[model samples]
Target: MQPGIHPAYRPVVFRDKVGGLAFLTRSTATSDRTVEWEDGNTYPVIDVEISSASHPFYTGQSRVLDTAGRVEQFRRRYGDRH
Candidate 1:
């Protein structure tokens, strides 16, 4: 609420490089690159490596860890003590 003490929170476009998706949202991050949004206004663009659109968990492609292998390895190393 104080004047000149807070960084400007403005609309920015976050583009996922791998997913090839873009969305507009407010952020405090600044960038030199700009992109014309659907509203026909240029907004600062921040290229991201991952986003909800391409995330495995959100896309229902969650990975299953091989816990059995890890458990066997742990048992071989430390299970004898317990």
Candidate 2:
């Protein structure tokens, strides 16, 4: 509750680059860029590379790791006893 010691927390817009999704949330983060929100006022625009909209796990686009190939490669390279 100390004045001037805390950063200002207000509504900010986070834009996901890949999915082109945006959402408003309260944050202390600030930016020089501004955009007119749906509520009709300018707010700081924060650009993010990944969000739930575009994330592999959330979007069900998750990739399977090539564990078998990696294990074979590791055995060929270092698992052999000299």
Candidate 3:
């Protein structure tokens, strides 16, 4: 716990544009852009490409890769040794 050597931690907004979601939380990250939150206050906003809101895993929209097909293709290309 050192004084004057740590970045300031304050309330900030994380915005997921693709998912159209925004949330307020404490972070050390900074941004020139700002947005008015539900509380009627402006906070530094950070735009993120992906977040839990829109992430495939979180949204349950992830595709299950066809591993069986890939394995068959590999074996066909290079005959299975075993």
Candidate 4:
């Protein structure tokens, strides 16, 4: 509990460009750009590449790697000689 030693806590808007999701939260992060929120108030806008909306795990669409096919391909290419 120090005086004026901690970063200023304020509301910031995080905008997910890919998912088109915007959220307002309190944090020390700031941005030069500002955007008018749905609450009729302006907050610092911070753009992010990935968010929960577009994330595979969060969206419940897990990415599946082609492990079996890749292994077979690798065996055909290298394992046969060995």
Top-lDDT candidate index: 3
Residue-level lDDT of model 3, residues 1-82, one tens digit each, is 8999999999999999899989999999999999999999999999999999899999999999999999999999998897
- Model 2: per-residue Cα lDDT over 1-82, one tens digit each: 9899999999999999899999999999999999899999999999999999999999999999999999999998899776
lDDT of each: 0.95, 0.96, 0.96, 0.93
After superposition, candidate 1 runs with Cα above 4 Å error:
80-82
Q: Give lDDT tens digits, candidate 4, residues 15-76.
A: 99998999999999979999999999999999999999889899999989999999999998
Q: After superposition, how far is residue 39 of candidate 4 from its true place, in Å?
A: 1.2
Model 1 reaches what TM-score against the true structure? 0.82
A best-first ranking of the candidates according to their TM-score comes to 3, 1, 2, 4
TM-score of each: 0.82, 0.78, 0.87, 0.75
Is 3 or 4 the stronger prediction by lDDT? 3
Please tell me which predicted candidate would have the highest TM-score against the true structure: 3
When 1 and 2 are scored with lDDT, the better candidate is: 2
lDDT of 4 at 5: 97
Prediction RMSDs, each to the true structure: 1.7, 2.5, 1.4, 3.2
Clashes found in each candidate (C-alpha, N, C closer than 3 A): 0, 0, 0, 0
Which candidate order results from sorting by lDDT in descending order? 3, 2, 1, 4
Query: Worst lDDT window (10 residues) for model 1?
Result: 73-82
2 or 3, greater by lDDT: 3
Question: Could you tell me the TM-score of candidate 2?
Answer: 0.78
The C-alpha stretches of model 4 lying farther than 4 A from their native spots are: 66-82
